[model samples]
Target: MSPNGSPDVQAITRLVEEVKKCVEALALPDRRAALSSLRSAISVLEDPEEAAFAQIFQSPIYNFAIRMGVELGIFRKLLERNGTPVSAADLAAECAAEELLLVRIMRVLTAIGYAGESGEREYVASQLSKAMVVPYLEAFAVHSSEHSARAAIRAPEYFKLHGYKTPVDSRNCPLQFALETDLHFFDWIHRHPEKAKRFNVCMTGNKLRRREWFEWYPVAECLLKPFERRNRNDSAFLVDMGGGKGRHLEALMKSFPSTESHLVLQDLPGTISSLENLSSGIRPMSHDIFSPQPVVGALAYYTHFVLHDFTDERCRVFLRAVASAMTPGYSRLLLNEAVIPERGCPPVFATGDITMMLVLAGIQRSKRHWVELVESAGLRVVDVWVSPDDGDMEGVIEAEVAS
Candidate 1:
């Protein structure tokens, strides 16, 4: 063992080396399976009881340190100072923070690999510290500390009040109870535009999405090739229902520029406005999903990560609205979502499922949930094709107008 090595250090080193080796085997047939298995094995080997115990003891302090780091602008300040190391005294003077508290927080950050210790009492921005300035992530961290985490603290009481059942209404979730608000999630977002802006764009970044719908969705067979031969009229070839900023649509248009598919994007007005530089070929329409869909009888109506934000009752409304505009036997509705397992969902995605439940009163459904949803909406599930379980969130549910 190294002179300064502890069990935690040894564990982390093994974890990193194991990850590197597993990643190197990606060219093999079971790359996904290999990665999945590696992840499972790592979960046990990486977090031995000793490390878990240490984590439990250290987590509260870690949270406090990060919260203070975000609030006091330690990350931003350190980044602005460039590669130069800053002493605690200098940082406290600049940020007007208490010197002792600032030092403690900085120590925590450095210990956690967020920053680098330079000299005896000075610190320099590490790569992770520099990355912290990404606006959305910082915003999310702030939002978590300010909001959802607080709601989580009240979980036992909120659950008891709600009969220990899953909340199905945004206005009645644990967050609503914690904040003592009657407003639904979207209404609350509207009232707080600053938070809404950060929250909405968070998913658009590469961080949230593992793969694109076109990677799994039968875009070429379902929409593009049909569009290539179909008559081009006022109606768009594909209506990207609730597509935020048309990222997928943009990729489609770029991928098949010559295809006759005219792209249209329908989303809430506020979300649409952020697409000021929306590509020329795509049409942007401010339309609510609950209302009747204005674009009718398109080749396909595509939705990405949208339905996961609504309860089944609300989802039915959305589905029926889109269904109303579909031409029987001709139009298709493609839903891009995460098909969480009935049980033992991966930890990364389970967090998302929980967030949807608490924040939007929506759900991350399994295959059973998808079938019920489609059948309830007066549609038939033609196919539920999933990508190679890159173990990334994968679901591309295709439905057509009921016969």
Candidate 2:
């Protein structure tokens, strides 16, 4: 290790050179890939025991600490200091916590490289910590730490008790086991209004800084041009099923301001009632995905990350409902989800698969799995548009009623 504590300075320098080369001539995805490679190279230099300890203890502890920091507005307070290192006592005062307790949190944060240690008991916010000050990011940190992470810890015992069978029932999954409740995950969240709000915020947070679906999808070629040809005459152009708070519909409306078409956002009545500032052409409807889709033969019925929450049988029921409403060749079903590859899938998505298994009995679907699911519901995939950025791992599977 170097004096600055980074491993193998010469190796890192070589990796940095590679990253610089990629950044100058490559797209963002290639640049990100190079950066990932650099990180992997650096990680390989870690002592075996250190790595083991980090995986076994440091990660969980840091996750909890980050949530604690978020609850106390520690990241925001640090950002307010504006490059000045604040003493633990000052931070404690700001957060209304004991100085010693604040110091303990700070120690872990600094050690984890989220905060900079300028002097004894003094901390400066790092870029990551400053970024956490964003509302959605903060919500994700807190929600995941408090809910997902805790439930994940119970997953092993959940599996052991169930004789290691794969979880296919959402109502009786690991989340139910962890919370010791028979309520489905969504039902449980609904019962806790505050947590439900945080969860919705976290879901929105997942979309932040990522490319919008329209950015990668050929929207005009697939939906608009055809709609104009038919002159659908005030018909719904897009129906975002299970759309929470109309975020994606808002984006769609904004993206195509000149197009005078109906954009519908559907969710449960409770979620629809709370929506505010919807774009002029957008409509909010109280509709459940499992129920018969009330809007028939829309140009496109879009569902984002919705299908991954249930078993194949449940998904089949929902898909069949949408299929019955589709207008043959005119109507389309667009599913935005992580299309997991059959082999060598990214760790982030693999981790997400396990988390979904633990919490919602959902499995991230590969292209093959998606095709099977679509066909089983009397729908056929038209085309799949994957985002060029691998980090996003999101794709839109366009499907329509089977012949």
Candidate 3:
């Protein structure tokens, strides 16, 4: 009940309590049912505007909370302590952060259901928070926060001051701008070792999620099967252009162990240098695909989630480079990306298109758009294969260099 003693408030409170009970009951046996119930409760409690606002505002708030967690070394500390609860003051002391700041961050986390506050200053990690603590997932948190902060900092000046309508209206987008000013993302991070380390940690953390996708889709295996049939000396190479840190390549190797292949990881000079200590079967090369692709005579050139990062013109340049670097016959170009469907599709990919607009001036393209883009690059779309478990927007598109 409200302190104002409103009957409507009392009724709503009772309804919310009832919904919670229903959620708990449904959750015991089936999580999907519980989630549906929770969604229903939200719909009942919140009007369309309120619900939309809650959904959108959560990204920035959650990013801020995650950034604070990273800065305070909360995940490392929690992992070291075996996921035990800790007081805010004690945590602050351990991380050398201010107690009040830690509490403030934890309070936000509690509100968002990432953590739970038991007493005045005591806090415990929740299941959701534990997921964030896992190293690979934690990288995603770090990336989200870093990208959000960079975008926010530039938003006011580039958008408001310049009278730009939206982020896309700005020249080069936030990421491209950052890259231009900072000598590209990998270059800047390389010069600043600390930032580079953080970036690596964040990227590696986020890789954990995509690693699961490989198990179901097995794009790596599918692409390598033909290569494995060839002679040992006539091995194929999965050239991951713009392959930062070879995370995808590592996953590919793990999936197709018998495929006698080499992983050619091409990126900026700085990123390539960082791979000096990388294990065997992975050859890190420093070459800008925008200039020219150096490697040739490969069985397959795999570009996973890299094409959508550029405009059609730029993507053509990239694909042209790939074509130039491949042998005429037997060589294939495999693009493992989301092939957006036109109608009756899920909202996540559509929403993802907006993020691309803000971050890199990239987009989630439909199959038609992909066909046009690849053809412009002198490549023909041979076939599109959807993993049994994958949704409409994501699939492997097999392509070949145009004659």
Candidate 4:
């Protein structure tokens, strides 16, 4: 072993130097590769016991602390200070939490670099902590802790009980097993108004992280060009199927403001009724996803980050419903989703696959899987458009009715 107890410190040091050079040259791809290598190197170099504690035990402690901090409005209070550190006593008094408990939570946050430790018994919010004040981010934390985390804990038990088979039953999956409910995940959320609203807000957070689909896809040629020549009776230009709060539709309107063709946003009745200030060009329609498509022969039917919430069997049924409505030669089915790589898949996606299995009985599909899944629904993959940006995790899969 080397002086630092790492078997390969020399290689790791070279990697660090390479990463620095890439950073100086502004070589994003090289930098990303170096960073990934560095992470792997560090994992190997780290003390196994420490790594185990950090991975299995330390994360939950920090998560619980952050959740409690959000509940007590500590992050917001820290943000209001504008980088000025506040004493534990002052923060506790303001947030109405016990001083000792608040300090313990702050210690965990500070240890994780989420909050800055300035002087003894004083703290300041980091950028991450400031970001936590956003409603969507806050909601994401709450939703994950309350729902996904619980399901994840039960996933092992669920697998053992179910003979380690992939979960495809929407109503009897890990989320239901953990929460002890029979309702489908969406139905369960809808039944709780506040939780439903938070879930919608959490979804909006995803949009902020990545480029909108229209940005990279051939929207003008594929959608607008066809809209001008389409059958007049087919007034619906685009349908945002299962679109929560119509954010994507609103985005499409902004992206192609000149188009006067119909834009419809479909969702559950509760979701549709709660929508406010939707662009007048976008029509909000209440429609069950599993039901037949009500707006027929639309230029395109778009589902954004929605499909992974279901199983292959359920998706086949849902896609068939959309396919039945397509005007074979003209209508395109746009699926904006992640396409997991067949080999060397990133940990984020691998984790997402498990999370989907646990909570939604769904999956993150590979390119092969996407083709198979789409074709299984009587649709043919036309193109998969992904951004040239290296970190873009999602893409648009353009499909149409098979000949």
lDDT of each residue in 140-198, candidate 1, tens digit only: 66677656677777877989987899887778888888888988877887799887776
TM-score preference between candidates 2 and 4, better one: 2
lDDT score of model 1?
A: 0.80
Give me the displacement of residue 289 in model 3, in angstroms.
2.3
Q: Assess the local accuracy of residue 299 in candidate 3 as a C-alpha lDDT between 0 and 100.
A: 78
lDDT of each prediction vs. the true structure?
0.80, 0.86, 0.68, 0.86
Candidates by TM-score, descending order: 2, 4, 1, 3
Q: How many clashes (backbone N, Cα, C below 3 Å) per candidate?
A: 0, 0, 2, 0
lDDT: the better of candidates 3 and 4: 4
Error of 4 at 77 (Å): 2.4
Point out the higher-scoring one by TM-score: 1 or 2: 2
TM-score for all predictions?
0.84, 0.89, 0.71, 0.87
Residue 62 of model 2 has an lDDT of 86
Q: Which residue pairs does candidate 1 place in steric collision?
A: none
> Which segments of candidate 4 are over 4 A away from where they belong?
1-37, 231-234
CA deviation > 4 Å runs, candidate 2: 1-27
